[model samples]
Target: MAFDVDHVLAEATTEELAALVCGSGSWHTTGIPRLGVPPLRLADGPHGLRVTEQLLTQAVPATCFPTAAGLGSSWNPALLKRVGEALAHEAIALGVDVVLGPGLNIKRSPLCGRNFEYFSEDPLLSGTLSAALVYGLQSNGVGGCLKHFAVNNQETDRMRVDAVVAERTLREIYLAGFQRAVTAAAPWMVMCSYNRVNGTLASQNSWLLTDVLRGDWDYSGVVVSDWGAVYDRIAALIAGLDLEMPQAQGRAEAVAAAVEAGELSREVLEVAAERLLALTDKAASAVRPAGKIGHHDLARQAALESMVLLRNDGVLPLAPQAKVALIGAFAATPRYQGSGSSKVNPRELDRLLDTLSARCDVTYAPGFRLSGELDDDLIDEALLAAEDAEVIVACLGLPDAEEAEGFDRTHMRIPENQRALVASLSEAGKPVVVVLSNGAAVEVADWVEETSALLEAWLGGEAGALALAQVLTGEAEPSGRLTETLGLRLEDYPSALMFPGESGQVMYGEGVLVGYRGFDALEREVAFPFGFGLGYTTFRYDSLTLTDTGSVVTRDLRVAVSVTLTNTGERAGAEVVQVYVRNAPASVSRPVRELRGYTKVWLEPGETRTVIVGLGIDAFAFWSTPHERFVVESGVYAIEAGPHSRDLPLSGGLRLDVPRLPSALHDESTIAEWFADTEAMEALQARAVARTGERFALSEQMYTVVAGQPLRRFAMFPGGVLTAEDVDAVLAEYGRSV
Candidate 1:
């Protein structure tokens, strides 16, 4: 007889129902064998499948794709979708039901140890890319778990730190990506974060899990707690968490006790059990047999597209016969991916030296160890190799120990020994091509100018070395761009002062100004701007046009922007066209420009194509504290078309006249705010001038003081002429006008 999940859930005792809500065995959820419900097996990570019955040892071999940081730089949703499909195939091969990632956490800080597993600093970019990954995985009969929900950006004190963020910042910056992913992809599961959000554990936060996620976003999926994230199982369940991972350690008894004591209602338990049964049904149907094809070639292709060519000076695409000196241990023993739970045990790992040697005459030396003592003899050997070579390619990056899960990096500089190696190699008079292999941004200002070319290969996976070889030899074009800004110094970042907070609290003091948005807002200089990359060829953007230039009036308003782009250079390559929107002066302060939309296009030499990007009202709206929602203020919005945030060559404008219902006048309202009501101001101005004479004049300085002061407070000022009755009459008139 076929097992019926619903029938079992409906008849199961309270103890059995509680057990089903928690994990049964390691990495597997409890299932009723009599009812035919099988356990849902989850495995490690966003980049690849790292599955093992044991938590700490002996992971099964799988295809290792580029980390999220590297893939994020690609900005190609289609490529990410293909990677997701490949991951789904591997998950099935490993007998895993849910692939536990496509981690959608925002890259709030460059020093965030787990940034390698996240997408970008921008929420829209992170959400759109992650949604594509989620869609691809689910379409391939594998369930994708969108994870580390809400403000789980840093690894420091990750399990307990309270991320204290403002309401507007939380909505616009921190939670925006997860919101986008939930609404767009509809992943089967959402894993609650280990950290505390505003002093409440995410697992037990009803507002985050139930009100915002289920009620506001209409998410019908099961909510699973991050392993060990559940504190009070009953509280978590009540908060809309349907599952506890890594097995039940007395949590089932606790849930049963709570339900028996009448503290937790039986209805809630029944609902939770129903959701779990639904998830089990979904998982059972999604299971498929593994395929025979290996994704090594696809991994290489992904790596090739993910590499951001930070700087190039005619030394790249070397002559076929140019003898090369390959320095640094990373070239021989590559740190292809990040450490921690996301680490993949690849079927095979490639080395840069081996890949390069297969194509050209190459001399190799371990210029520096990633950690501890550096060998002077090895440095001398590397110098000797560089002395004889026509060009030098040095692979240098942060070691696995420098940045990884469970801790945040203290600084953003490259390891000292690697820095020394680069300095010596660059001083050797041979053109140096520096290849970086870290997961996050490192300061290159110290030695970047000396290098002839720079390639940011961020923890590329098993085939990263081969991809690097191809790009170095001009077999492929460097199409990836920087997803986060490469700052000149750590102090230049907006969150530098309060990052990785202390005393169990991390404050998001920077608000919505994160990454390039922060840098642009503060006008800080950075080593490389976000969305900046150099390809083998050049492209020119011209003939900018806005299809809808009239006033926008509705929430569903959209403006179509078209720009003609041409490959001006000789080489065939790809270019990412970025579109940004700047709202004319509004009630709230905003970034000078925010990225609204972007699309990547491939072109032959001298090819021209017109790309049309659509912009909706959300692109022009801000999270309004007064309105308690996203609102578009009636104003002119400037449309900027560019290769990156800082380099806009084409521009257009749109006038939007969104209708907004004015709030009722109150004592707490500012004088300027009251004056916004023209009829009310007209009635009060004449009465006030008559009482105070020249003292009540609206001069620039006088406006500065009184414009922000509350109307009630101004009425009580020493020389004030306005009274409570006077303000009430004006408000009454304002209310009448409405």
Candidate 2:
């Protein structure tokens, strides 16, 4: 039956409207039977449906696909869309109206325990993949919720920590992904994060929810709070937060009292009721019949694409009949997904030992206990099993307690027992294939050189074990890539010193540089760079071309790039063609190169294809503090294409003549700005030297300090040679030249 949202809102009393804005039951909002409005049930997703029974302790069985970290490595939007659709089908089957998913928060630090739920460190990749997932979910009649709305990067002190970030940094790096997802996908709902942003709680930050999301991005959707994220219901509603989750006690009473006392406007309550009713109307038509949707096959396919081959020395594609030693407890009991609210009760989970034993002569041994002290007998048993086999596959990873949703990881190293197990297995005098299963990047620098091959299966969902077995035995190819940089040491990270924060605040000192951008800027060696991955076959890139190399001032202008890719090896494989743009003579400090566009393509042996990717004006733009918006400076930008960010094999240049005029020069402008005017620099310097004589013959330190001072301030110094008139003349000259 069709529901009228306006009629429902007009009839709702202040008490009813207040109750409607917040949840009436766990994971559900109250529905007005008198007005023909039904309750909306939300489910946890991004990978699978996480429907819980009473008390939220027991979860209903559902399909578990690859986690966001693993999916991000696939770099395949079409695949993500398919996964999203499968998740939506499950949600409908379970009587869920919305799926809380597609977390677009940037992987700012490797130590973030919840990195498995996020996408990539780069905004372009994260945003694009998130948009695809959102589209797929909404297409199936299920509402998609883009979550952790702003700078909820780390899990430590998440409920109240303040992200003390610069405005430009927030715009360019941290918030860019969310902006892209909101503008492109138009998700049905956006989940405000648990933490505070710039001293204001995310639920009550009007600049973020109202000014940016609803106003600037034109998002016409409900703004829901993270579970238990609401501190004040009336304040959150005024700030544009339409709903609070988990049915907080006394919230309705508090809201009604606030409205009656004139503390909260009645119009705010009506607007919130209207948005909730509208969402109910939108979801009413898409509800499907109640039945289980089998997604195990889809889960396996997703896991296959999400596995990353980090290092290989031609020892992969194990023979099906070869004798193999699976030496790890995880082989018997897999750690397929992370813990906390997003944890899924999978319908079925495949074990690598069971799958591999069915096809080959496999000797399995528990290398070490997943918890408790390591037993010497178990280590000896694992060593014996490894020595008797042709090849040893050691499954090593962090315990669930080490990395989860409540806190940040203190270090990047794997558990001590797991490291020991790998060390012992490495000495078995056979080929060692180290398979890492973790939520975030772990240090492989210690033992990576000794291992013959490495596979980074980042918390692949329920069918991950089957996918691992297939990739090992030549049933599938490893096509996934690194979404975050695998750093050599934890201290080497740009935000290492300030990670997890202290005293309720975290500073984004790295600015726009994060992940691979940081490694490139510092010229540091990483275990694996972003966008780096390997497959059985090799690809060669050639014939790079740019469609429009001419200048353009508007943001709407786009440049098309085409490159020929050839599979020169003897196998079917996939390749992710990454395009990066470097600003020649950057106007401000920026990364050496930023990822602009990328696409994954499959090729047969000896196949050749030309891939074309378009670059928008935002690709070459940066957040300008003076302009309070993104600006593309008039300069030449070099576009480089290759397999990864660190290895660009093809290059082309495009000159953009943006029509953005420089800001009007004033007396408060830095002295360095005045010196940059070549027409006025010589005259000003000569006058200074003539007036101050030897004092004007300043040292480098003095020059540095004086150059940064405002022109007006420098003119007021006791022995200052330049006056306000001289500064005015310089500005007049600059204006004339423009």
Candidate 3:
């Protein structure tokens, strides 16, 4: 029988409603079978699906694609959408309703263990890519869940740590990506984080889940708790979290008891039950096709685009017949995916050593163990292989123990023994190429200069090795850019001091300045800037022109931009034309430049293409604390177009003439605020002139003294120029305008 969500919601009793809002087991939502509501099954995803009915760790075979770090670096939203569609097809085959990911948390710190699952440090990039993925997933039958809703960055004390952040910072940085994805994709579900935001737990933070998510962003999706994230079930439900996962024991009875006692409204319970039933209906209605996917080929293609060629002294795209020495244990057993619940059991996994051997004259050696322990025999064998080979390809990365979902990394350096091997290989008089396999950015400043080439093949899944082989042999190009900056040291990061705070509270001291924004603001030197990648070919950017497409009367503030891109190098390649915006003097401090929009264009040698990117009003707006919303202060904004953040050759400016928003005045508003508002200042001067037949006047020095004081407080002074009644009338009149 086709499930009628309306009928089921009407018939469900209070007890059944309570049960319906909680999960039945680990991966299934609670369903009132008596009311004809079927359970919706969910599985862990973002990279790929982990569908398991028994142990969560042991899952059926699914094609694991490149992780978000890999996908984000690709800077191709269209590719992400295709990947999402492939995931949806696989999810249907595995009997899962929703795939719980495309984790959009900003990569605040390199030490964050779950950085693999997230897209980028920049909210615009993460949000844009995630939205594409969501659109693709839902376009097919399967549903995608946008997860760890907000500020769930680090893994250290994830379930209990308090993330203390300012409202502006939250709106601009941490929560911005989720906001973008929610508004753009409208995913079927949004999973609340485990940790507390500010002082309140995320599960019960009404401001985060209700006021901001639903009220402001208009997210009309079911809010589910991260597995075992709920502490107070009644509070979580009341705060707009509709469902509790992993079957919270006794919570359903407690909810019913609360409703019976009038402590929790029965209407809220009914609303929650209605949302669950609607979700079940939506899941059941999706018509999934029979499994017909060449996921392995897609994984290979994605992995190829995800490989970032960090640096090249012209040694890459090695001669196909060249003798290559394949060093490091990772060449044989690649760490292609991240650890923990998001891990996938690949239907087929490729090894770089095998792929290289099949293509060229390659010798293999275990330079170092994955355990990071020193072994003299392995080092000697690797050096011997390098001695006879024309080129040395050393595969190195963080071991599984170093980075996972449970804890944060202590440092950004790769294994000590691996660093030792790189040093040894450099002395062999052969061109050394370093192939990295970590999920997050690692410290390469110390040893990167020793190698002729560096390839940041971040946690490419399943067919990653085959992709690496292709890039090495010139069959494919390394087109991925750095989503996060690779700083010289871990301490260089803005969140280094406060990340995973000591006493259960982590302060977001740096505010909105994160990733390249922080680096650019401080003029800090980094190993690699964001949106930086070198392919087998080079490209030139010319003639950047921006046309104001929006009207000032309507306050649209949209700009249509076009940049001419030509492939200067011999080989065909794709370049990600990044468009960054810089606001002309504002009241608040902001990043020097923020990524507003970007587009990837493919070009052949001497082929020119005009790439168009549009900037909306949000590009020029900043979250104003006093106004309590995103406002674009009237000014000229500098628009820059380039390949990366640091290398912009084309620049233009757009003057926005939108009216400044009236100050939100109140009794507590400072005297300076009143004077700053032209209308408010004119009204005060008119009243003073009516009484004394002269304009209101105060000495510059005297105004400075009283500028910080509240406007109403001036009336309290003995023999003050203003009376209490006069002050009240001004406030009453001006407050209405605001």
Candidate 4:
């Protein structure tokens, strides 16, 4: 079962190595028969398995779990891990090796059509949840591929558009989650994105694929390109890409020729081939259980945890005897998943109309066409059905065409027809409960107040409808939180000005500000903030404490935070406790507060418990451009805790003693830079007194004019108070040479 990689690489022929580096077909790798490497099968679906049947036309039926957007709101990594384990069981039954999944791309913009497949807008949440999923899958003997590797945010012009971002922004916002996932879980494989980063395609960018991913993070896993991402096969290989996915004609022969013609090194070819052989060996030798496992119950529980109750006016938990009118065609046939490569053909799907009719006196009507067309008859029928009902339960969502994999959304509003149906039902003066089933946030400020209650039941897979019914009838409680901010309008987003850019490039002009970070920075009001959710019961936060758990000189700072939470209501429910870190005033711009740690807990009526969440060095650090690394300036940091981002009721402060980062100075260094250092300032003042019998001093008026001048320019000053020798002494003693 354990084969030596060096031995296999040494014995592999040039042709065999070339073939091993690329996939043998659409869903399999090319195995070396003589070397005992068996081909490994791959499948799609991050939330389920989608193994293709013969001719690659049809896929086997599998359990369709909640999409990533739905799962992200749960804020329960433990639940995601169980989902990953269940998915691994199905993969093992279908003879699959790697499941391409757990996409960790930041939700930079809500208009990104593929937002349904990603986790959260913040990096810490995304990375932590993805690491849990990866751990579950790999522990169960199946591989999890963490993907669309880096900054593949928008779908428009995805294959060719260049993502132009600054180094600090890239490190802090775009690449932070990937770093966390790689460092924590060590996924078996990482899939490169189709888009270009900076100006180089991800498949051939040595800096990203090699320097950062491999050299910086010390990742040893195989680097596979997204399907059809490789434009230059040899270039990708030389850039540290271990595999090219899918089947391509003439790829093996071209790779072999490149090596023979001295365009590629044999050593690089062998390294790539060795990793493939090792992957195949592990897959072929894995030991898995022999029977099937059921996950409908788990899927239903996940759906329950993922439903966010946005607003409630004491109308939720409808009485069992209350008559209900369920409106919308989606109630009968739900769009449970997004339309794209990750879509799965569910083994079974639950319908809300059917589930509700079985429990209470319910009337159903097709309120609007699935295409979002205005039909006068459907609207009139819906109004009539609501006349005799005690409550109107309206299910609404964006049509499949509005959000998909290949393009970006043009607007944030639901179809006017769906909006019209809700408006008509609200006029009846009865309590209206609007349940949304979209993959991302939709604008609701205009009409949300019209309804008595609003519930965000995202694209919750096959068992979603059953879960919604339970939440409505007091059988279950809503515990989901918002992973992305819901702004009042699409134009309110900071990224809206330059999203999906033109001219073959998109600029990340907002820098580190994305999602709730941008909203907090701009002091903008949103329909709902990140981590905001309402359950049946209320929780009070108090008793905040912070403890340092690691040494300061080691530069590995860890703070243990504990908060006492109490259930102050009459019902049993769950709450997601969010913890954020706010740095002291600094030179660089930062979010008002960044999410550092979080936990989900269940409490009975009048129950109290102390929850502890820890913060590491990365929590208080920012990417310093001058140092070209993550640097934490010594300062006192405020630790805030509450149920949501905006409603922090508990606060504590901790002072960290971080060593001062060294600044390299030279002849061209600014005069302000020299004065900022204590030692250099003393040297310059001493030189001034020796030359002119007076200590060095500059007036505010003079400083404004000369603060930006180079240190060497002081030699040109009147009377030569500070000479070139003085500048040289400061540079030599207190700074590195230029």
TM-score of every model versus the real structure:
0.95, 0.94, 0.96, 0.96
Model 4: lowest-lDDT 10 consecutive positions: 285-294
For model 1 the local lDDT of residue 209 reads 96
Q: How close to the true structure is residue 86 of candidate 4, measured as C-alpha lDDT?
A: 91
- List model 2 lDDT by residue over 176-295, tens digit each: 888898898889999999999999999999999999888878999999999999998888999999999989989999999999999999998998888888888889866454545669
The true-versus-predicted C-alpha distance at residue 667 of model 4, in Å, is 6.0
Query: Candidate 2: RMSD over Cα atoms?
Result: 3.4
Clashing pairs in 2: none
Comparing 1 with 2 on lDDT, the higher-scoring candidate is 1
Each candidate: RMSD: 2.8, 3.4, 2.0, 2.0
**What is candidate 4's lDDT per residue for 601-703, written digit by digit as tens?**
9999999999999888888889987677888877788999999999999999988777667765778887787777777778778877887898767799998
User: What are the Cα lDDT values of the candidates?
Assistant: 0.87, 0.86, 0.89, 0.89
Total backbone collisions, model 4 = 0
The residue-level lDDT of candidate 1 at 561 comes to 88
Model 1: residue 640 alpha-carbon error in angstroms: 0.9
Query: Which tens-of-lDDT digit does each residue in 372-417 have in candidate 1?
Result: 4667887889999998899999999988999998899999999888
Instruction: Work out candidate 3's RMSD over C-alphas.
Output: 2.0
Model 2: how far residue 679 lies from native, Å: 10
